[model samples]
Target: MEHIPHGSPDDPNPLRRLSLEQLRRRTSIKWRAYPEDVLPLWVAEMDVPLAGPVARAVTDAVALGDTGYPAGTGYAEALASFASERWGWDTLAVERTRLVSDVMTGVVEVLKLITSPGDAVVVNCPVYQPFYLFVEHMGRRIVEAPLDERARIDPGGLEDAFRRAVRGGHRAVYLLCSPHNPTGTVHTTGELAAVAALAARHGVRVVADEIHAPVVSRSARFVPYLSVAGAESGFSLMSASKAWNLAGLKAALVTAGPAAAGDLARMPPEVGHGPSHLGVIAHTAAYRDGGDWLDALLGGLDENRSLLAALLAEHLPGVRHLPGEGTYLAWLDFRALGLGDDPAAVLLERGRVALHPGPPCGTGGAGHARLNLATSPGILTEAVRRMAAAL
Candidate 1:
């Protein structure tokens, strides 16, 4: 197969290049969840065509009838290469990595290995909604360490939660969302190092969800949790799905730090059976050959971030948008609009625009809405206009 040229950063913004009609044709939940009249800027899914390498890799496999159970460590090796070249982290040992169904599934399985049922799991509040749902569903208790007023990790608050979580000699795990969702705050190295120290002191195991690691803009750096000085016992879950827009292809890696390799080794053999063979192929292709495409996408997301801030300031003056350094998600505070806890509900009902409500994101999320900014600029403009109209 001929290699696809990785587009330059100066290329036209991919997000602005797609049409609404083209996006509506997608069968994914992002488009199908809402009626035609309603604009959906809710889900994490991006509105762009598949990267050439990923599309070809999957399509070529289907053409050859290569569908079967996943095998080999190609995915792990590819990720190791990507990590080394991208972040200068040359310590990613492929032997410490295990393939699983997706990031959340990997998180659950890793937590199971480290903590039993009824154990406590700590999380930063106003985080990704699934962190709450998945942890609770796994029969674990959730303790909240709410982010400080600036939406950055509060060392004191985290220490308090860690201290509380391990008070009874109970096992606890701190579920971290790096390059955090909704808020889009890219955790600094100093911030992550502090978290490692706190977790170490409290005997709390850290499991970082780094699915959005590759989506960071040029302005911010994504610090892998396990790379911190005191985090040799931590675990990290990563995948190419989010960056490549391949969520339907369910495959992810659970990487263990040097101290946690034994725990990862103890994960049930059958757990590896969950990932689709095709998903593995697609993800492997993404990590190995999708770098150029990823750079191009990041450029588009950066533009959208600026566009969103300008639009909100001009159209919905009451809305406060703190643009994130990573991910295409925009966490907008609508409390000034006097819309109560869930302004998203009102936006959907009155404005025919859909957004993920802030309350569901946990404490500090009230009166805020999470908007997906991975769409065409036109859609974003219209969504804001409708939101203003509703207000």
Candidate 2:
């Protein structure tokens, strides 16, 4: 790497090369269907290398051969410390913090521990999808409370859902997502507080999935459920895995109120004993020293965001997207394209770009597509180009 003078990177042609191409050339996986050169905008991992701190930690842990059956361990301490340092909130002590195979497992286990069959669990549509499956798989009835057009959470709608559930003699549980998955809407503290009040009134249990809390946008504020006034009486699901792009490492933290945590703790030893030991090393590394890399990565994302907006307008004018306030995911409206109401199939298969269709995200996501901007700028540009050509 040569020392290039630090100057305006906004010049149409920036100094040096983009890491996006490096990742693309390195990726041996065939993303698009045969015969199609794929430009994958799917999966949550960043195309760039892991943060130096996290990288060093993972490497050192590997050197130490820390892999083992991470049943009862220091993993909790690592997660709690991370929470205290980053979020400024004292998460339940490590002893109180339970581990799971990963985030999806935590969400599933939490839902089952509280709600019963036929009970109403409130979910904002176009959710992470696993929530719906978790509820349905657990035999709980789903209370559909969809997000508004802006992708911002609708507290009033949520309260209405809670009110309706209580009246129907159905137990209500809230599956919350902040700095949401596909749409990337970071729920405001006030909105979350309003929802919390409504749920408390209806005796609803709130299971907040805040995995994306760490990558918050510069102008946005992402408040963890437990950080909210009523969160001590709530459930918070978070982990360092998402923030560090270590999802494959497999570990997440689940904390809830006393009674709830105790009840949750006893369900099965398997629930808490499922986290990966490697993930623990990565978690600690990321929380303790990855801030610098994260900031630089965010800067890259900001540029990519601007590039995406400009590129879409100039080339793929048919595709519409909200400058994602937070999260690497970008939600695009593709209805304007001649591809009719939805263009994911046409884009992914015909256009050779893998885009998560919006309908699966829920009603608000309909006629929409979710693009992961976590990759390199060049890759994003190519993705947009391919999508434009397909349209």
Candidate 3:
């Protein structure tokens, strides 16, 4: 695929083109979930406009009336190229990759392929809420390895969970949230290496959800779980949905490491039938030609990250906001406010600001809420003020 450069690093912000009114006009879940008077920050959708390349690709496909079932390896090849350029993961085998309807579907399907019903899946708690729900729905037991004091992937805690997950002759699976969700702590190469070793020793298969890897901050570099040593037994779920704001398109890639190729080969043929054809085109364009736009979006999000901290400090000093190294999500600890566990409900009803409740995210989430930071500074400031006033 040919890639066209959209802008340079010196380019002005491309994400700020849309105004708040323009954003509210969106019919997506993020905008439609709450009343116009309420500020909706509960969902993961970003309030940014589409990258020029992605919009053009989707438009061209529509113009051509080329909306057949998805075909070809364009999405996988584009992702492999992006991984090589961005993360120094040059050994990725595009042929070993598969397509899925989305990240969560890929995770659930891969879990099904590797483990039987009633097997255990280990996840870091206070993690992505869907991890617990999907695993349980798949008839698998949930084993949690809670994050350490600093909200990092705890190596010791992981090994302990792995031991428990594999007990009683159960097939064990580890659902790794790389550059993790909510907390935004990007795992180091050493941490991933330790996880790989532990999973190997405990006979656990590692499936990494790397959808947020592309939006990392300048202060941190994202390391692909499959790129680390001893990670050959793992699988990765990746998509352009989160970073490119293409969630409505519905497409994702499920890549298998060299050692796990045979396991993925067992995936049902119909499993690849759900991805949208336009989604493939848009995702391909984002990976191939949207580099400059991504860089600009990163610049905007980095500013918002700092802006959120300043707003929180001024309006709600008691709230502990840890600026994460990646993702546009902020995990706020509201314990200091003496709010009961899951303060999001209080904020939503009283402050008229919707945030994702924490307790549903499992351990380490009491008295916390996950705030979406991918919005205008004015909106963020207003949300903080409303939250403060709710007190």
Candidate 4:
């Protein structure tokens, strides 16, 4: 797609075009060791800014000064439009959609609405750090199901975990991540179908997080949990934030199920009805007409991913390379760095690179540092170069 030029805003830092030098400079977490010379491949935000169409939309909204509270508007309808275009599922009925603050909010709300305190919620390990916290923070019990090596979903292990949870009198829901995070292994249709089927029979709800759905690898297209037979019977939490880099904008689409997404509708006729209006406007712009920009962004990420993999193979030999199946987050096994289990701390203290300390993701996460590869290829290469030097 030809670049569409959205007139620039008058900000000192209007996120526009991406440059390797600029990306390297921009994303380096400030105040970390390694001085100005070190590169930081941490942080999930993409180096590329919003697409022109998206930029124009937000600019237009700002121009028209329609930045009021997004309440009671047809936010659901807009989200449905996006779902239809991307997923080939024509979700024409927007009534089932509710705009939450963000994907985390949706996940927390779904858990809160469906399961009571002390009820066990299942989550795969080495996941987004928030997964563990979300369950515990809600006073709910957590069922840990760690992913196998290569980071793919271990179906047998998952089923076993669920069975144990059920047998223990702790039956509830699964906090599922599509295009699985950290490792980026997108779920196979067969695997997802099996998960849904199992949850359905055992009366377990599957709250699928589809925030990173847009930038999936070409070999892997993200299939929404609700698209599966048993998913809508459960619930889905989606947002345009990760796809379009509007997380700070705070817009998310949640499909709560069955009779109007089940959970959201059953709320005593007086609950679960609030969404950010700013998110609504930004989200609609992303879903309806942000396809071309998304394609370009994916193209950039694809290049960056290859660059990183090659660097790891060549320079950082012995670092376990968990294949990136979907998202741009590359789980680098730094165990070979031989800095004990906490390479993340060593990286920060000695290596001087600010990485997401791997331990927080639980169990298997110990030796793994999740490196965000959603930057320009130049930046990724330099980041790897710096990291290799540090090691």
Where's the lowest-lDDT run of ten residues in candidate 1?
1-10
- lDDT string for model 3 (262-309, tens) is 999999989999999999899999999999999988998898899888
lDDT of 3 at 333: 97
lDDT of 4 at 303: 65
Give the residue spans of candidate 1 off by over 4 A.
Answer: 1-12
Minimum summed lDDT over a 10-residue window in model 3 is located at 1-10
Give the local distance difference test score of model 1.
0.90
Candidate 1 lDDT, tens digit per residue, 159-213?
Answer: 9999999888899999999989989999998999999999998899999999999
By TM-score, is 2 or 3 better? Answer: 3
Q: Write the number of the candidate with greater lDDT, choosing between 1 and 2.
A: 1
The RMSD (Cα, Å) of candidate 4 is 5.0
lDDT of 2 by residue, 153-200 (tens): 777788888887766676677888877877778877788788777777
Q: Would you list the clashing residue pairs of candidate 1?
A: none
Candidate 4 weakest lDDT stretch, 10 residues? 6-15
State every prediction's TM-score relative to the real structure. Answer: 0.96, 0.88, 0.96, 0.88
lDDT of each: 0.90, 0.71, 0.90, 0.72
RMSD in Å for model 3: 4.9
